[model samples]
Target chain A: MEIRIENLTKAYGDFKAIDNMNLTIADGDLVGLLGPSGCGKSTTLFMLAGLNKPTAGRIFFGEHEVTDIAPEDRGIGLVFQNYALYPHMTVEDNIMFPLINRKVPKNEARDRAYEMAKMVQLEGLMKRKPKALSGGQQQRVAIARALVKKPEVLLLDEPLSNLDAKLRVETREEIRRIQQEVKITTIFVTHDQEEAMSISDKIAVMEKGVLQQYEVPQKMYLNPGNLFVATFLGTPQINVFDAEVHDGKIYCAGNMLRSGCMVPDGSYKGGIRPESFNVTLLPSAPDAIRAEASHVRMTGRELQIRFNLGANEFRLLVHSDMQIGVGTPFYLTTREKQILLFGQDGKTVGKF
Target chain B: MNRKAGNVIANILKYGVLIIGALFTLMPFLWMILSAMKTNAEIRAIPPVFFPSKFSLENFTTAWKAAPFGRYLVNTLIVTVFNTIGVLITTILAAFAFARLNFPGKKVLLTLLLATMMIPSEMLLITNFITMTKLKWIDTYQAMIVPWLASVFYIYLLTQFFAQIPDALYLAAKVDKCRDFKYLIKIMIPINKGPITTITILNVISNWNSFVWPLLVTNSREMRVLSYGLVQFQTEEGSAYELIMAASCILVIPIMIMYLFLRKYIIEGVTQSGIKG
Candidate 1:
């Protein structure tokens, strides 16, 4: 089901934990609520799941007013980060809990629990209690329990945060596969940008309880709406430079950066992804950032050359075969399409 | 000072200390049991007898008949059962409210509950006795049960237990559309069975052995509990040491049985409360 959150707000005494926030999840879409800790991502998810009521505003699930609805009436499945499986019950019983509470027959609940167990790839562990299972298995059982009721929408709040590195990777892939197979209107909340970018069909970036940007994964990465979105959406984070515009050129750190396009007069900052830059002492092409190489390190397939320009250090990725030493000078040219320029207020000024 | 000798001495010291400590702790109970089975002369002997010279069931029979011991036992059972059940039900419900539900006066109410815990039971004894007397509850079961029900300590214990439960569990329950009361009974209560069970055993033991409050309120022989019954059994004509010991054994047996059955829960309850205290 499609979900609409309009001007939702939650306050603790005087502090607005979640300010006037708005978001809309299209039906059957896998959306990721991505943010750092306490940025209102989990709060938003909780409000949507009907766990925490918003102090103000409304929520709609496909034209149904769900703002004031009780959690059980919301028809949503929630997989908590801690799993929340009943410690005293066996896997089968924990998975069967929702169905039993809904007055489903015992035999039917057992059958559905077993079926969900198989779906989560937990076949032979039904008799084991949650405390008896390993972390990964317990997590799978928790997922199975949430899915057993066949909720219209599934909300996962940092479902992989508790797992170790190997398990986190494995479980996140499984979650993505399960979400795709079910095609439920799913919202995954996480602070890890990489996790969101890799799995979500669409991503909503939040900062300080405000919606920074919302778009498809590729659009959010390639055309960030602001500095926060740009910095939060990419790995090997995009490099930002404090620059000035003069005579159709961008001047930064005692260098005239070549750009085929002219930036506005007040555009004081520009962001460039590392992959956009080409490493050379003198580029045959124009519009390149000039700097002295201060450090170099080999990273398996590439050499990361750190350039020193004034007080700032910019990193450039180049082929490992290209030998570069410290104290060497280099010119780094970026593709016109990959540059994301921002103004004084951190909002996007222009992009080609 | 060789290794073998050092290890042997260490083992000896360990067992010696443990055995001595065990005997020291159990001496009183041992004395009571021995005295219960002894004649009055044996009980009053110059030095205490570890074992009785002449074993007799006479003191047990006398103690049983000297007062309505059977009726007191029944009264004690009724009061204990009602008090335990009342404490458990009220504590769980109120703890759940304080732990989870958000209402306008939640903080104020929780502070009040905690504040009530700080008032020692002795402080309320006079006021409670007055209240009971004016209400015409003296010699009534209500006097023994009502004033002691809804204990703030048990509520605080349960609140701590319920609060340890992850918020996510409640959220998951909510998403399943489980009613609030049903969720409390089905999910929250079941998950926290450890602490709740511990609290129940504790409440049972305390209520069963209750003396002061029951003594103050119950004026009739029929309403007396175990501790009060023990006191009332001793007459000024002559102290029946053998009969008192026999009665003490009777009182000790139920608590021993309760502890044996719920030993695991009792230990856990003690340790959990120890950390908090």
Candidate 2:
């Protein structure tokens, strides 16, 4: 089912947790709501699940407005962060609870529960309670319970956050595979960019209860809508510098980096991704700025070098085959397309 | 070797104090049982006999034939069983509402309910009695069972337990389309078996031993509970200490047996609620 969230807002007294957020999730598409803590990603997921009521909004599940509907009637399965399996119940009974609540016959419910357990690879453990299961197994049981009723939309709230690092990766892949097999329109909330980027067909980046950008993962990473999106998406973070765009020339720290700029003459913020910087052995190269390598550390296949350009310090990742040492001077240059300029208001301006 | 000797001495001292305390508490019950087994003359002997000369069931037969003790036991069991069931129902529903539901004036309503706990139940006895009289329910089982069906302390205790359950569980049930009452019966009550068992045992014991309410409400012999029946037996067998002791033993044995069977759950429930007995 496709979901349309129109002008959704949730307010707690004077504070708004979600502010007029509008989004449309395509049918059978696995989207991710990505943001830091308290950014309202979870709140949006709850509203979508109908567990929370919006202050002013209309939510539609394929042409039917369900803003006032209860969670159970909304035809969406929600998996909580802690996988709230009934501790007193066995895996089979936990999966069968929803079916039984719908008044399905006992035999049919048991069959369906067994089928779901088999799908989650829990058939052999059907008689064991939740406390006896490992964290990953408990997570699978929660998913099986949620999907046993075949809800049209599946909502997961930090589903893999409780697992260890290795288990988190494995479980996310399992979740993606299951979501694909079920062909359900799924939206999962996560604070981990890599997890979101790895699984989601589209990622919606949010900040302070407002939607920042909604695009495919690579597009949002490469061509961010604004400064926050640029800095929030990447690991090691994008390097930002205070610069001036004067008379069609870009100057950073009293040094001219580029000319023939098209942006209006004023102050702007310049961002350069760490991997975008090019290193040279030559003392002087055209459009190459001189930088002194201050710190060099090997990180597996890449060398993370901290270099100083004038008084500014920036980190760069390079192939470890290059022999670079501390205090060595090198020429640094980047392609024009790699440079991102943001106006004073933090929105991307004209062209790089 | 010196440290081991010191530890042994400390252990002896700890158990020594505990043994003395246990003996002090058990002395009265021991006396009652011993007195009940003795002949009348042995009970009144100069230095009252610590042990019976020859144990016999003579006093028990006499006590059993004196009045309708069997009838009183039956009445007590009926009132206790019905009262426990009623209290459990009322307490669970009220506690679940207080712990989870959000409604207008919820805080004020809870404050009012809790304020009733501070009013001293003795003050409400006369009012409750008058209400019973007006309902024409005096000298009936309803008078004894209905008035004590809901207890604020139990409700508060269970509300604490219910509140400790994660809200995610409730939301999960809601998403499954389980109604509130079904969730309570299937999930909340089952998950909180220890506390609920404690409440049931406590309620059963309290109902079994209830004296004042039964005394005030019941005027007929057929409607009297065990506690009142024991008092009546005492007055009728005045100066016959052996018969009185025998009747007391009969009343006390059931409670002791019940405690022996359920002591583990009692301790678990008390510690879980963080409340002293």
Candidate 3:
């Protein structure tokens, strides 16, 4: 099912959780609602699901107008973050709930539930209650229950946040696989950038209930729309330094920095991902952006070298096992393609 | 030896205090039982008899024969069930509304609902009695049950439980189009078993013990409840003490059974709800 949400707004008295938001989700597209907590990604997803009544909006599923439709009639599957498994029921009963509610034959509902349980690798645990299962197992049961009705759209609200890190990765892959097999129009909400980037075909990044940027994950990572998106999308985060344009180059703390088209007109803040900076021995090239090595820590695969650059201690991720000492001056180079410059208002100024 | 002996004496004193407190609490019921067994003359003796010289079941027979107790037992049972069921239904609905839904007057309505709890039950008796009388519901079951159809304390209890439900569950239910009358039955009601059971047990016990309203409204002998019947038992012509003791025992038995079954829930409910953080 293709979902089109237009001018969706939800207000709680004076506070507007979602404000005139609009987005189109293609059929079979595994789109992600990506943002920090309370950014209205979940709110938008809820409004689309008809769980929340929009203060003002129109929603369409394919050609059908479902703006005011009841949630059960919308034929959407929802996987809650806490799973929301019917604690009173066994796994089989939980999965069979929607089917039974629809008044499907009892035997047929059991068959469908069994099939879904198997699909989610929860076949052997069908007789047990949710409280008896592990977190990952319970998550699988929740997924199976949601999908048992063969819903037209699947809405997942931070479904993997409760899992441990190793389990999160494992279960997310399972979720991705399930989505691929089902090919339903899916919207997964998460504040975790890595999780969204790894699974989603398209990501709708939001802030303060406003749609900041909606694009494919690769494009979003390679080219974020604003400082928030840029800083939010990267782990270890993007390094933002205040700088100004003078003599056709950006100058920072009495040192020259690389200038792309962003420097031509005026001053702007520059963001560089930690991995964007390459460090080498001082003797390799004397004229590089010079910094004093202050601290170094090994990260198994790479050395996270903390160095002082004009009273600011910035970090660089270099290949592991290069013997380096404190107070040793090193040359740091920024990747031209990786540099992101933003205006004072925090919107993307231009690429370097 | 000195310190150890002092510690032993302190432990004995603590136990002695607890046992005395327990005996103090239990003395009323024990005396009621003992008085029922004693003759009126024996009951008035300078030193009350703790145990009758000769046990008798005579008061049990007289209490039963007086005031149609069988009918009163049925009346009390019906009123308790109807009152509890009514309170449960209304409290769940009102609580769910306050916890989940947004309406124009919701906050004001909730404030008003909670405010009713502060008004003492005795203060409402005259007006409530007048209303029932005006409605021609005097001596009717509705008179006994309708006034208790909604309880503010029960609503507050269920509302606290309902509010604790994760938003994700509501969201999941909504996405599936479960937000109608169906939502109450499917999502909200089923997930709140703990509070519902706790409320049901509480309402049942209160309704069973309730005396004032039933006494005021139920003029017909058939409309009298167990508590009213107990009053009637006392006024029997030439009352026998042994029969009254047995009657008191009978009245106390059902309460004991209910408490036995719901003891944990009662304690948990009190601790969880009685204290405000």
Candidate 4:
């Protein structure tokens, strides 16, 4: 089912948790609500699940407004961050609970639960209680219980936050697999960019209760809507510098980095991704800024080199085979397309 | 080696104090049981005997025949069982509401309810008695069972336990289409087995030993409970200390047995609440 959230707002006294957020999730698409803590991503998920009421909004599940509907009637399956499995119930019973609540016959409910357990690879563990299961196993049980009812939409709230690093990766892949197999429209809330980017067909980046951008992971990474989206999406972070645009030229720290920039002449913020910086061992190169390497560390297949240009420090990712040393001077250059300029108000300027 | 010796000495001192305390508490019950097994002459001897000269079952037979002790036991069990069921129902509902539901003035309402705990229950006895009289419920089972159905302390205690359940579970239940009462029965009550068992045992014990209300309201022999029946037996068999001791043993033994069997749950309940709180 497609979901449309129209002008949703949730206010706690004077504070608005989600402020007039509008979004439309396509049918059977796995989207991610990505943001830092307290950015209202989880709040939006709860509202979608009908666990929370919006102060002013209309939520539609395929053109039927369900803003006032109760959570159980919303036809959604929500997995909590901690799994929230009933500790007193065995896995089979837990999965069968929703079916039984709907008054399905006992044998049918049991069969459906067994089928769900098998799908989640918990076939042999149905008799065990949640406390006896490992974190990953418990997570699978939660998913099985949520899916046994065959909900149209599946909502997950930081589902892998409780698992270890290796388990998180594995479980996310499992979740993606389940979502694909079920062909359900899934929207998972996550603060981890990699987790969101790895699984979501589309990512909605949020900040301070407002939607910043919504696009495919690659588009969101390569062409952010604003400064926040740029800095929030990438690891090691995008490097930002105070700059001025004059005579259709972009100048940073007294160097004319790019000319013929199609933006009005004024002060602007210049951003460059860490991997966008090109490093050269020679002391001189065309339009290359001189930088002194301050730190170098090998990270898997890439070498992370932190360098100093005048008074500012920056980092860049290069092939691990490069032999770079600390305190060594090098020339740094970046393509014009890699440079992102934001106006004084933080919105992206004209395209490169 | 010195630290180990100090630890051993501390252990001895701790257990020594505990043993003395246990004996002090057990001495009166031990005396009652010993006295019950003695002959009348032995019990009333010029110098009291710590142990019976020869144990006899004659006092028990006499005590059993003296009054309708069996009838009293039956009456007590009926009142206790009914009252415990009523208490469990009322307490669970009230505690769940207090712990989970949101409403205007919820805090104020709970505060007012808790404030009733400060008024000594003895102060309400007359009012309750008058209400019972007005309702024409005196000398009836409802007279005893209805008045004590809801307890503020038990409600507060179970509220604490219910509140410790994560809100996520409640939300999950809500999403699963489970109603509030069903969730309480299926999840909350079962999850809190220890605390519920503790309170049930405590309530059963309290109802078993209740004296003042039963004595006040019950004027007929057929309606009297065990505690009141024991008192009546004492007065009727005055100066027959052996038979009185035997009757006392009969009244107190069941509660002691119950406590002994279920003492683990009681301790677990207290510790769980203490640590969680």
Candidate 5:
């Protein structure tokens, strides 16, 4: 079930959909192909399923090369974005279609289909057509249909994107549970960063038909290789300010914050997570970002204060017990380890 | 109060036009039934009769005996049924290829197939007759049936509908190892029930009403369809208008029943196919 994609590329005339991609997904590993729309994530998934032929490269499932094989012969199961259930078929029939296609005995196929449906927890609605079921239910039917054949690798394209917010969370957790029980190597494609981070063992982040970074979720969050990866992963995104290192000191908002910076003497982008900032009444604290608070709002237990530093705006999370009025001058400090320093080329050159 | 009155007036105006249109359309049918039972004197009157003074079976008996109407019924049924089945087979195959498969000159070939529809069937009558003669298929069922086998219009209609099916479903079928022909029969045909039914009803109707090609190729009384036998209603002296009307009624009733049962499919298929075309 280990998939190895080497030097794969798919081009439409002169425009490449996937460009020289390389990755190795270990057996039983759940990998997420995460990217924005038209970023070639689906293209990579399709190539792995053998639904699309790579322009130049080879794909190996354990030992055999499946680059030129037919899709059915590739031992892969694929779920589409809209679920793609046959409208004419009841849930039972839809789930049983793959088994029947393999020429399994009629009753045996029925038993396996029922078993898979139950695994996906679609027990009572087997007689209803796709239109009769809810979006999450139809998606379950699609999953059952794909897995009834016991494919070595399961590929799902934006499987939970059609569900409501609450349903999406429940369905994703359900998918993770099912994938764990089956222990089949699976690739989940989505544009949502939180969903990818929550369920994936590892993520292969793509951009403009190229692989930007491939790493574990926690490592990718804390240590992004480039500005794009840092910005793409967190909500209320990582705030990046124009900064420079002068005389081995990091300077921002017309003040020196830290000394002995790792990056050389040059302009750089300094990224700080929203939760990494500290706010206080002290305006002259050392190694702090100086700003004037514009607004303060309470969200549950955390107090969020909006502040302006020069022309750019940023927000900080603080303890809700402390009362801070608007238009108050404050100093914000991000721990040195929490700062990400990027070079002129938009890539991290200094970790601290 | 004014709005309610305006609504009532608008409703009346709308239904008044619709009811008048329905009666106008039904008038010919009313006239045909009335004339079939009327005496010749009433039929030849300055104005047509609305209803006969006394209902009579005289015209039905006369029309039934004048020609082999029973034999013509059997012949027309055989030709229409076989023509419809054959045309469905050929057109579905051709349309599936045009819609799903990719090959060299596919666009040009489809454009040419569509272009052939503009050359009215009348222009091909002589050439087809020559072909029938060369094949020595004269006075045979093949001449009548084979000439209408491949229809460009039906192919285009089916292809347009088939193209609307999502490419993802086709890929899913491919992954399930369903071959092209199996996909057509099991997936495409079943899901596109509307268009297929539309094609079947239309094929039966057009073949049932066919006149020219059957006239050119079939001359014997045994080979003539219902339309050809209707010619027997006329002679060099004068045309028998009453018996022809009676025969017309007999000929149309079966097709009417068929349409009544299949009108839902016809409307659905026409509307679905009409979206793109």
Candidate 6:
């Protein structure tokens, strides 16, 4: 189902939990609602699932307005963060519960439950209660239960958070594969940027109940609409510095990082990805900005070097062969000529 | 070794105090049984005879003959069984509503109901009696049973248990198209078996042992409960020690049997609910 949310808002007394959010998820498109905790990603997901009433909005599944519909009538499958599998029931019964309520024939419900369980690799564990299963196994049961009814839209709320690191990876892969096989329009809410990037066709980045950007994972990284989106969607974080643009040049820490850019002369926040910095030990390099390495961590094949630019610490990810150490002076330059600039209002300031 | 000895001494003191308390509690039942078999003079004997010289069934026969004890037992069971069913129904519905449903005045209503628990039963007794009389329900089984059918304390207890159920499960049920009442009966009630059993046992006990209301309302012999008979056994002439003791023995038996059977759930329901829920 194609879910279109129009001006959705949820206010808890004076605080707006979801502030006038609008998003369009196309049919059979796997979208990820990515954000930090309390960023209203889950609230958006709940509104889409009809689990929560939007304080102000119209939600549509295809062309039908379903904003006022009950959760059971919404035809959306929701897997909760904690799984929320009925602890008393066996896996088979858990999956079959919705089917039974729909008044499907007994044999057909059982057959469909078997198929969902098998799809999630829980075939032999149908008789086992959720408490007796491992976290990963229980997660599979939750997925199977949610999918058994063959819902048109699948909603998952941090479905992998309860597992250990290894299990999270494995189960997320399984979820991705299952979602593909089912071809249901799946929207999963997650605080993990990497998970969203890894599985989503389009990732909607949100902060403080506002939608910052909605684009493909790589595009969201390459071209963020604001400072928060740029900083939020990368590992080791994007480095930001307060700088001024003048005479077609962007100057930061007494160096012109980018020139021939037609941005107006004004102070702007500068952003550079950790992987974008080029490190050279030679101090008198013109294109490179100099800083003393305060810390160097050799993480397998890559060296994570940390330095101070004034009061803020800056991090750079480079090849381990750079042989950088603490207190070593190195000059830095961006691999790309144009640095990302955000104005005082926090929106992207200029053309690339 | 010194710490081990101290632990042993502490354990001994704990069990020693517990043992003494147990005896103090059990003493009355034992004394009643012993006195029931004795002659009237023997029961009144100073330094009250620990044991009867001759164990006789005479008190049982006399008590059984004088007041139609069998009919009283039957009448009591009828009231108790019906009242228990009624209370369980009312309690489950009220508890579920209090635990899950959102409506105006929920907080204020809950506080008011809790406040009602603090009012002594004695304060409401006269008002209840007047109501029963006005309804022309006095001396009726419905009069005896209906007035005590709903208990705020039991509803409060079940609400605590029901509240402990995750909202996630409730949402999950809603997704599966299960109605609220169906979820309550199939999911909530069965899962909280310990608390439900506790409520049933407690209701049965209160109804079985009810004295003041039954005594106040029922003037006829046919409508009397066992506790009412026990009061009747004591005449205005004097207390009939032998018959009263025998009647007391009969009343305690059923309660003891229920306690023995459901003691684990009772203890679990009473203690675990406050912290666990």
TM-score of each: 0.90, 0.92, 0.87, 0.94, 0.96, 0.93
For model 6, which pairs clash? none
Candidate 2 residue-wise lDDT, A1-352, digit = tens: 9999999999999999999999999999999999999999999999998889899989999999999999999998989999999999998899999999999999999998898888778889999999999999999999999999989999999998999999999999999999999899999999999999999999999999999999999998989989999899888798888878898988888777778878888889888788987887685577788887889999889988897656666888888888788987778777668778998889987546
Candidates 1 and 2 compared: the better one by lDDT is 2
Model 3 has a DockQ score of 0.45
**Which candidate has the highest TM-score of all?**
5
Angstrom error at residue A316, model 5: 3.3
Q: Please say which candidate is ahead in DockQ: 3 or 6.
A: 6
C-alpha local distance difference test of each model:
0.84, 0.90, 0.82, 0.90, 0.88, 0.88
Q: For model 1, what is the error of residue A342's alpha carbon versus the real structure, in angstroms, after optimal superposition?
A: 1.6
* DockQ in order: 0.61, 0.79, 0.45, 0.83, 0.65, 0.64
Where does candidate 2 stray beyond 4 Å? A280-287, A293-298, A321-328, B1-28, B39-50, B236-241, B260-264
lDDT of 1: 0.84
Q: What digit string (tens of lDDT, one per residue) describes model 1 on residues B37-129?
A: 998787788876679977788888888888887888899899989988899889999999989887899888888878887888898999999
Ranked by TM-score from best down, the candidates are 5, 4, 6, 2, 1, 3
The backbone clash count of each candidate, in order, is: 2, 0, 11, 0, 0, 0
Regarding DockQ, does 4 or 6 come out ahead?
4
Candidate 1 residue-wise lDDT, A1-352, digit = tens: 9999899999989988789888888998889999989999999988888778899999999989899888787888888988988787899888998999899999999999999888889999999888888888988898888889998899998988888999888888999888878888999999998889888889999999889988998988998999999988776788888876766666667676654556656447878887777777776556566677788888989888787666656777888887678887777766667766788899887774
Q: Write the per-residue lDDT of candidate 3 for residues B1-277, one digit (tens) a residue.
A: 6999999999999999999999998998888877776766776677767777766766666677876777878898899888888898899888988998888998898898888888998999999999998999999999999988998988888899889888776666555445556777877787776568778877887888788989999887778888876665455376555556667777777878988988776767666666321
Task: Looking at model 5 chain B, report the run of 10 residues with the lowest lDDT sum.
Answer: B268-277
Q: Model 3 residue B175 lDDT?
A: 51
Tell me which of candidates 1 and 3 scores higher on lDDT: 1
- Which lDDT tens digits does candidate 6 get at residues B181-270? 999987898789888887888788778878988989998889888987787667788898888999888888989898898788888876
Between prediction 2 and prediction 4, the one with superior DockQ is: 4
Worst 10 residues of 2 chain A by lDDT: A307-316
lDDT of 6 at B81: 93
Chain A only TM-scores, each candidate in turn: 0.95, 0.96, 0.95, 0.97, 0.96, 0.96
Per-residue CA lDDT of candidate 3, range A1-352, in tens? 8899899889999998988888998999999899999999888887777767899989999999899888888888888889988777799988988888778999999999999988899978988988999999999988998899998999888998999999999998998999999888899999999999999999999999889899999999889999999988977787777767775566566666664353555667877778887677753554478787788778889877787656555777878877676777778777777777788899887776
